[model samples]
Target: MIQLPLTPPGQTPLRVMTIAGSDSGGGAGIQADLRTFAMLGVHGLVAVTAVTVQNSMGVKGFHEIPLDVITGQIEAVASDIGVQAAKTGMLASSAIIGAVADTWRRQGMADTVPLVVDPVCASMHGDPLLHPSALDSLKSQLFPLATVVTPNLDEVRLLTGIDVVDSDTQRAAAHALHALGPKWALVKGGHLRASSQSPDLLFDGTDFFEFDTARIDTGHDHGAGDTLAAAIASALANGSTVPDAVAFGKRWVTECLRAAYPLGHGHGPVSALFRLNG
Candidate 1:
């Protein structure tokens, strides 16, 4: 009998964890993150921070998971299956943020894994998603541990007290945010201009990368920021460097927006599977 050659051990897929709220509408939050990870060919794991009763129109209501439960979920994922990179969105309370930071520190995973903080404070329809008190905790604890923080203009204003009206102001705001200790800061420009092109600024401590894309003039963009940040985390988990990951993420989100399909009565989600069909 001829002996067959034995196959070597299979390599594990890049694992990414999303700590965020659940979007029942499946347009944003954990749902969007998982979809983005799947599109990027990575294993997506989730630790839901809260559950929102929402639809395309607006958030109806929300129930935040207790701090201990949040901590347990993070611990369960990090200690057992492990993660290459993690991204957080919609951390509802100051207690939750504090607990999450503590758990990450205790696991010694704070320094090893790349953490992307989306700082999702509110919904697309002007409803608050995070508690007002959580801002201080996020700034003090989570920001310092983040590998990258992806914040929109309003979020940047809230975090750094800098109102970004133009490109120069955006640059100044990015620099100020970077000074808070995150290794990199991505200031999203989606909310900035409707007439001009949309440009996102990425600051890596010393240098700046201005990513400009033709703004897709469409109403089907409910979860664009969440998708962008998740794509970045997925790229990082797949071993892409910071700048390359951000670049690819920017391109991916732009495509998603360009290829978006209107789903709901109001703002719709981007087509996360656009690349799959390409």
Candidate 2:
């Protein structure tokens, strides 16, 4: 019989938690987050708030986990193992969002743990992931507790009634979003059609850091937001400052999109292991 080698103590990996939905497609949501955490050398934990029946084409259906179950999962992971940072994605309803925020506040971990909120209201294929009524609850409960709020043009428009088509509009939207109480707001420019290159605007309530990258024209970009937010959370868990983590996360996602693989009939997924291959 082969004997397993025993490892030394205190060699545990950096832990990061994701409070989000589970995508059966394995391209976005918690699945993408877990893959990103693994690639970035962080231990990934999940508190599943909903389960989505999605595919390469689009989201077929979804079911929300009970509020108690969601809170129980958060408590179970946060109490025993503990997490350095966390990210949220694809919350199904207003009640769910409120429950999660309340639980986190009750645990008194809001200040200690860095939380990245990816306001994922719709799928890349234009399918609705969040209920319409949940929008207000998300703004009221989740946004205030976030260390950083990552929103694309569509989500930013939904969050703040501003159209971010040009650079000036982008700046205005970023500042408006920052006023919503998050320490930082990263307004992504993937939907900005005027510019040939993608320019994401980052506002830390004071200054703006614009990250411009050549947009990789590919159909395989199913989990870009989840990937970015997860990478930021992992970076934070590894002791990076907010701005540094956002920059690193953007770089990682850009590389991932550049090396994306064609896997499905419709939009596939970005390669989360691009760094390893290089």
Candidate 3:
């Protein structure tokens, strides 16, 4: 847990950093994270990992940011402006993942600051964002440093090899992911389409907390995963407990879904325009 100043240095809002890729679509990745942070009253900082050519239709392709530049961005923000919490998105390759993990560890933020790992394997349109060879690196290096790992069903299967079809299996998946070393595991059930209301389960080794919400019928949920993870990271920056942060995030993203609107011919993004009220 991070203890943040109500008014950080230079009298700015509590700062939360998103060490993620840029979504030219303005739907997910660093774009969605910055929106979530701003709406939640925290200043958002970026350490862009990749520049993805993507939109409502799908991810066409991407260009990875150099490892040195990625590390430099992280250091530039952490050493100067500082961060109350941080989260990771599309790390395109094994080298990038290694760079981020090593930089974070060397900065001594692996334990001190709150870290949210959104194991983004693919886009909503079924496009692979991470390199196949980097999956092991993601698991081995990043997971152990995460304060909370937010993985959807697809990611859950990719990481833990568990098919989360029901509540029990969600629990099993949570346990499996927690074993990878994150202090908390959040298994999002937003991918479970058959259920009218599938609750996201959060496990902290011994106990389990489920955040149940009625399903909103909409296909414009392209950035829902990123939105949820960013909301958690933002709340952590705001000094919320892990359970409370997850709770707030669940509510926040549900509204984002409720406010979702269509953009392109295919699936659109959940609106981050659903700002938090004073």
Candidate 4:
């Protein structure tokens, strides 16, 4: 493992920006991202794309943020506060995704900053978070600009039209997703119920790295994806390469799953606060 002091004495904490949505439930979206960023000892910045009426039960509804305001937040932060790496989650519409892509490119961050795209299309309870029309825009604009695109199994099928039943199919899906333009495609097999373990496949067009863990037995994993992506972005901001960053994220998130707790009356959230307990 590539070890570095996360918060060395007397140095500024690196900044990591998350362009995502607000979860009233507070288990996922911007809430989870910021929590993960802070846990990793990085400055957390936000460009909130939408506000959702959701809870541990599920998403009831959402209202998208104005495109201009979304872009403005990105500008205000990158221009002054500065972001070393960024990630996206729960963009509600094609318009928002396209605008985010355009704004990031215009700011000259398209190539400079590493971006983790967590394609959050639906809530864990099967409630849709993204607009129906936004899928194409997400792929056409945002995917091309991502350093690494992390997608759950459902998202893998949505992105590549492949059903990931095993490691073989996951690899195929990774290849198909890589063809969409991200430098890396991480196919998360957390939902692969047929398997005894959760295996994630990372492909960089030429090479493949696999990260897996014995599945934590819990229904309270609401923020796992967001937390993982946020951890990856945090590592990138702290100067880790993409592969190392993903590895770090996997380890951190696995620990989080071990500490997940029930919330509300339904499925709860994966605990990003796990480290605090340790």
Model 2 TM-score is 0.95
Residue 73, candidate 1: Cα error in Å is 1.3
lDDT of 1 by residue, 119-214 (tens): 999998989998998899999999999999999999999999999989899999999999988999999898887328888999988999988888
Clashes of 3: 0
Instruction: Write the residue-wise lDDT of candidate 3 on 1-278 in tens digits.
Output: 12223454577788889989899899899998888777676889899999999878899999998889999999998999888899999998999999999999998898789999999999988899999899899999999999999999999999999999888888899999999999999999987865779589999999999999999999888788888899899888777899999998899899889888898788888887855432
Which residue runs of candidate 4 sit more than 4 Å off their true CA positions? 1-4, 8-10
lDDT of each: 0.88, 0.89, 0.89, 0.90
Give candidate 1 misplaced runs (Cα > 4 Å): 1-11
TM-score of each: 0.94, 0.95, 0.95, 0.97
lDDT of 4 by residue, 105-164 (tens): 999999899999999999888899888898999999999999999999998888789999
Residue 179 lDDT in model 2?
89
Model 3, residue pairs in steric clash:
none
Residue 98 of candidate 4: its Cα lDDT? 88
CA-only RMSD, every prediction = 5.4, 4.5, 2.9, 1.6
> Considering TM-score, which of the candidate structures 2 and 4 is the better prediction for this target?
4
lDDT tens digits by residue: candidate 2, 1-278: 10112224568887899999998889999999998888777789999988999888889989999999999999998889999999999898999999999999998888999999998899987889899999999988999999999998999999899988899999999998898889999999877998999899999888899888888898899899999999899888878888888888888888889878876688888878776664
